[model samples]
Target: MSEVKEMAAKQERQALTGNEAMALAMRQIEPDVVAAYPITPQTEIVQIFSTYVADGLVNTEYVPVESEHSAMSAVVGSAAAGARSMTATSANGLALMWEILYIASGTRLPIVMPVVNRALSGPINIHCDHSDTMGARDSGWIQIFSENAQEAYDNMFQAIRIAEHPDVLLPAMVTTDGFIISHGMEIVNTLDDKTIKDFLGTYKIPRNLLDVDNPITVGPLALQDFYFETKVAQADAMMKAKPVILEIAEEYEKLSGRKYSFFEEYRLDDADVAIVVLGSTAGTAKVVVDNLRKEGIKAGLLKLRVFRPFPYEELKEALKHVDVIGVLDRSDSFASLGGPVFSELRAAMYDMETRPLVTNYVYGLGGRDIDLHMIEQAYRELLEIKETGKVDQYVNYLGVRE
Candidate 1:
């Protein structure tokens, strides 16, 4: 414990924006290859990393691709060749990689991506929102969300380990809200190069496409006969990732003195009303939870850090005690019922013996501000639902004019 504490004390604390933190982490990792196309919010990440490559700060093979689709394809090829590979993108950029996203995961390449969350384009908006990543929720990649620059940095280290683990050889992405965590500066405690290298060890995949002596086909066509079994294997791998994620997080805590879990619980143990949220909004919700607690309102918060394996069972256990819960979403699902996170939470709690009243609040679309007042109102509404034992509407939009 003393050694761990000493190691933590030795870590350098630096002021950086979320994109810079991610870039620094990548630099320390010194991945063999990086293929990315520039996109708003996420552009700075690749831009900074490219400089590292040019200046010989890191011996990385940087590939400037034409589009997000080509970028992902390039990463897939590099990773399949058993090289550590990564990329960064946001919004429409992620949308462009939709096809390759599935291919990377399907082929079980451990490619790490930093998806700076931005609103998906249609009306043409470039701002903080989960719509981009949320749209790719079913793309078979491990998804982790960060609330601040510090978390974004830390999660980047964990993501590489998580994705490359033998039991969980799948693509993984770390997400930070665009222009919120991405562009905003904050203090981040970063591990030294040696510590990070030792912690991540070496990039060694069990199998690779480039292995000529013992070769195996990747992404081969499987029509109906073996497709189901392959999918089962993928599902099993995802299930196995839950425990691996926890184990890696525990080890990370030992190195950095910063603990992490699938979801962070803030005063949720004995609360009657709670709000659940993701990304930067969790910070605002935490402030509201602290204020409400001071007022003896019994309000609490559940901030989801991992959204991929969904943490269904653990989350169900965490929120089991609350009487009423508000699930906040930065992007709507357009299903008319609720947003992505909200719908998932509802499904997780559906089988519980005594379920709490859960409502969905879609807020902060197109980078709209989600102030403390708005978060407080969500908690207040939860209180009302708890008292009346009735929810007028299951889905509600926050900070929007009706």
Candidate 2:
């Protein structure tokens, strides 16, 4: 038949929004279970995947729940039952699942959730911000930030492999900026279904609650007598995930012809002034760095991908030579001092032999525009710090009306 072709074909390049790309990856993954509730910004992902389920494109049991809490609970039950499970959410949806988030991780279920980063509500905004995931950063899940649609697509395959790895049996949340990357269309090169399937191999629940022959408890009461040890074990697994993530990324690179590391260092080695950021903002920062370099400003940028394990050591080594640094945040920490990213970054470099003057620029809350001009201003401030050897303002709100 001329209809069917060989599976070894080159990757297919298609224009896809981040939500569609993530849904496409899930269709290719064909996980055993996907229990989710619709939420702004993230609803499209599961909605598209539901179409796959309807069209018989995938064999996944799609469960549509009423609330994010129920959505997460259903997946936790599915994951504990030894099913490859996944879910997607945004903003308040993630906040609603706060209780179950810990349960999913505490039980060591390798559930993969695609969190569309959105600002948490009091004012009820349905836009991009890192506050949702940053709020759950300490919940024992690996946090991966995507710069664009392609990373969102590629990270899905890697997230499943990383989460299910025996040495690191933990959940992972691959995140994308709400409307910025989630709804923005871009050309993405996607692997064929067979390629991704082969890459994922097969998943067998090592501690299967469904396995009657080798029955084991999923989650039981842990007081101070064993709560500390249980936490230590989970912490150890999280630490082991660092190497597993890199290893899985390496394999995915060979299959996809795209390389990845914990974070991307864009012209940072010889930099005198550096900017460190996460999510879609990094894309804007890279452009600013290129223009600054053309003007002979030794400017550089580092875009962090993995945020949970923190990559403290690698970050320390990478920024050791830079003269001054700036960290831009899309979400305010509201702690009065600085945002979560800037705070963690300062702590990471605290023990350096000669730490650079660091500045925190909190911007883009509630999906506010963070354009090239704003990013250029951040770099200029870092240059000032480099020149004067002092930071006039340690923390700032970049585009606020004051």
Candidate 3:
């Protein structure tokens, strides 16, 4: 951001719920098309944006679909036709779009969806949890998790650039916790419409369906031979997304003065025990770490921002110095071992010459509350692991009554 714009942005910070902040960001960016289906916490976003269209605030087509499945389909169709497109949805809504999610990324569409993280259900819930997004980790989309409303707002612009980057034309989802970030209000420093417009520049696709002079097919069925190659190509693009994500983050930081990375490190230098987490719970964990430090305990936190295109190598180097690390997951993978994050981190650290002793802490599934006490217990376990040089159990559930 320019110095004057930055100062104005700081002064004009608005108190908004995550949904309102995201909708406002969408308005600022003003993509060509927005096709969405509302569910619980995510409903407010499109509801707010729909009013923008009605009031002539943004020149964008707003499609209110019957279901999340149709919502994703609408964006995919619009994006393939070379329009900048977006959507928003919550847990069950996200699940409904499962099939189309893969097709969106597989066909290399730079669609952006803001997902409000909620527990995926058989018991049926409408509250905060990571199960919804965690279940779609391998669906060929870039997954960026937000800690609060501010990140949710900022990430929308960054996600647009990242998804539309020349080398990384993949669908992306920026997620915030349901009820936690989505319904709660916080002050967000927002860029002006002109700044976001300049940041996004223009939306272009090399071979869009609408280009009749240079017609090309999209989403054709591929059998065993070519399909394997397509998968490999998509994987290559996903790996390429890491650098693109970071580069865009640096540019965004210069613009907004809010730095972001694959993960955030909090006082890791001299700490012996640390906690690794994702989403809003990281905020709670930070408080626990702060209190632990005041008592002379060497504790720290690493809050992960990007889950898909997992930063395996960078993460290993970051945590190798710590003695014991507690990797917390808000979703249960239920493989009889632990959650998705624990398995990935353990594997990532496997080859580190001086790796930290890591244990899994599965907490806050189905929107169960994880208070400061739960985070403190996680740190306590880490301290014990550091002191004894032993991990009694690799997988442990937190704040749950057996």
lDDT of 1 by residue, 311-384 (tens): 99999999999999999998897865899998889998998999999999999999999999999988888898
lDDT of each candidate versus the true structure: 0.93, 0.91, 0.91
For candidate 1, what is the TM-score? 0.98
List candidate 2 segments past 4 Å from native. Answer: 1-9
Error of 1 at 203 (Å): 1.1
Error of 2 at 275 (Å): 0.7
Give lDDT for model 2.
0.91
Residue-by-residue lDDT tens digits, candidate 2, 1-402: 121123224778899999999999999989999999999999999999999999999999999899999999999999999899999999999999999999989888999999999999979999999999999989999999999999999999999999999999999999999999999999998898988999998776687878889988777888979988988999999999999989999888778778788999999989999988999999988899999999999999999999988899999999999998898888887766688889998988888889988999999999999999999988988888888998888789999896
Candidate 3: segments with Cα more than 4 A from true spot? 1-11
- Choose the strongest candidate by lDDT: 1
Order candidates by TM-score, high to low. 1, 3, 2
Q: Write the per-residue lDDT of candidate 3 for residues 1-402, one digit (tens) a residue.
A: 777575656645899999999999999989899998879989999999999999999999988889999999999999999999999988999999999999999999999999999998879888888999999999999999999999999899999999999999999999999999999999888877887899998999778999989988898889986999999999999999999999999998877888999999998878899989999999988899999999999999999999989999889888888999998999987865678888999888888788789899999888899999989988988888888999999889898887
RMSD of each: 1.2, 3.2, 1.7
Worst 10 residues of 1 by lDDT: 1-10
Error of 3 at 214 (Å): 0.6
Give the Å error, residue 24, model 2: 0.2
Give every collision pair in model 3. 1-255
